[model samples]
Target: MNNIKSVFSINDLENLSGIKAHTIRMWEKRYTIFSPNRNTNNVRFYTTNDLKKILTIAFLNNFGYKISKIAKLSETEIISLAQKIYSDKTDSNFAISKFKLSMFNFDAKLFHETYDKLLETKDFEIIFYEVFIPLLDEIGFLWQTETLTPIHEHFISSLIRQKLFAEIEQAQKNANFSSNEVYVLFLPMGEIHEIGIILVNYLLLKKNKQVVYLGENVPMENLTTVVHHFNKVNFVSYFTVQPEEENLNTYLDTFHQNILVNSPHKLLVLGKQVHNFTSFIPSIQCFTSIKQMLNTI
Candidate 1:
């Protein structure tokens, strides 16, 4: 019980719901939607339940339901309405809301259940781009604002990583590796964000391409082993951080000089940090997304 986060500020509510703090306060005064409690410091705080209810309300309101109408419905009715949207239209918004609810409540069951439901109607790639990516993007903002803790972030990331691994395993069974260009995936040294690269591995494997997933904070020199082994290779990475903007050009120069200067191998990259890159030779390419990389290779 001590590990549970039981309360949230209005700012937390805003960050999670994508609703304005002013709008939430207006909803409170105009309707009986919230009854926030005061802490010892007299700061207004809401329960986990309040956050859930607000998320549901926001979900419903987004689909043309008026707040005045939503205010009159019972909690069950509101949730039923939200559920009906996903049921009838297969709305991604409701799934995103359900995921956020699961994260807040630490409900692994709900997370899996929601994911399984999505799988019934959508392919893994669609679900990933539509549901998971947007949720992760919002989660990043929420964490930056202190609306969520590391515990919450880790809980959801672990769940998603589990799914990625499961899917990657399935892809591995069908991998032919007949393509001459063997792909090598890794994160830069001093970098630890690996979800993107793991997904890239699964994507390549799904296409029957060969991939060697070195994974998470790999030094540049480590590539010599694969370089020595595979005659044709495409070294892939997703740079969320590490290789700071100031160091990006220098890092690219070093990698090109050492890894691809005279060799036939190439480097393919995807991530926000690559926008910091200045210039690169034809052998070194940076992608804005996994989709773009797929289209190219």
Candidate 2:
């Protein structure tokens, strides 16, 4: 009862392995690296084993091993080579390749092991700032280019979110919580992306500050109600895709006029949409990046 699906298309292979369909076809014809099965209607399809093999081959190719050398290796030999590659401390490409393979196969154990190994030599903040953020950005690009599907993005993001949440929880457990200025982190209505806001909450909690996280798609009106009760509350939000560009100015204007103008508390904003009104943005300190905001705090 493994319940694993078998058949996959060329596009699926490309998405899972990061090997272009055209390139895969070329490898098949020119190098005989892979031999895919054809359906009755002459459509190319690959199996689970084929997907694993291609990922292993892609990992080897990324590590400077020529395609010819990769093709000559037996399946057992390829697995052995991947195991050896995983042990190399200097090979970030190998680690990233293994991470991709884990994501493709939904192998959480492998993902955790690889991340833990990386953490032994690199700090979590460095990993987050240098590796994970860039990887997520690349994932976004892949999504835009139709190289990955929503399912692929969601699966990987969910795993990352789990890790972030665990770290946040541990930080909260050790927090001193002596601050009077409690931050209330939230996303405005229609904004379901909460990863950035979650990270901010984590940062605040790590600093031992009280954080009230009202996660994703929160109504602005509801936030106003909370602000009325919590006098020491500082409202923080991330605008990734919510409040469409056309309406961003209106939203900010209303928010500034109603919530920020008379209130003693401050509003901290970040993400791409914040740039839309940079010229018209009030003299109040609103950060454009997490680093800027963290420095101010």
Clashes of each: 0, 0
Candidate 1 lDDT over 41-141, as tens digits, reads: 99889998899999899888889999999999999998888888879888898999999989988899999999999988999989999999999999889
Q: In candidate 2, residue 18 scores what lDDT?
A: 79
Candidate 1 backbone collisions, by pair: none
Model 1 collision count: 0
Q: Which residue pairs in candidate 2 collide?
A: none
After the best TM-score superposition of candidate 2, give how far the Cα of residue 258 lies from its true spot, in angstroms: 1.8
Listed in order, each prediction's TM-score against the native is: 0.96, 0.82
lDDT of 1 at 141: 91
| Cα displacement (Å) at residue 112, model 2 | 3.2
Give the per-residue lDDT digits (tens) of candidate 2, residues 1-297: 223345778887887667899999999998887788999999999876787788778878777888878788888998898778767644565666666666557788988887898888787777677667766776777678665566666777887798889898898889898767889888988897777888898888877889998898887777777776776777888988878888877887777776777668777888878754463545244567888888987
After the best TM-score superposition of candidate 1, give how far the Cα of residue 181 lies from its true spot, in angstroms: 1.2
> Please, what is the whole-model Cα lDDT of each candidate in the order they appear?
0.89, 0.77
Question: Any idea how many clashes model 2 has?
Answer: 0
The prediction achieving the highest TM-score against the true structure is 1
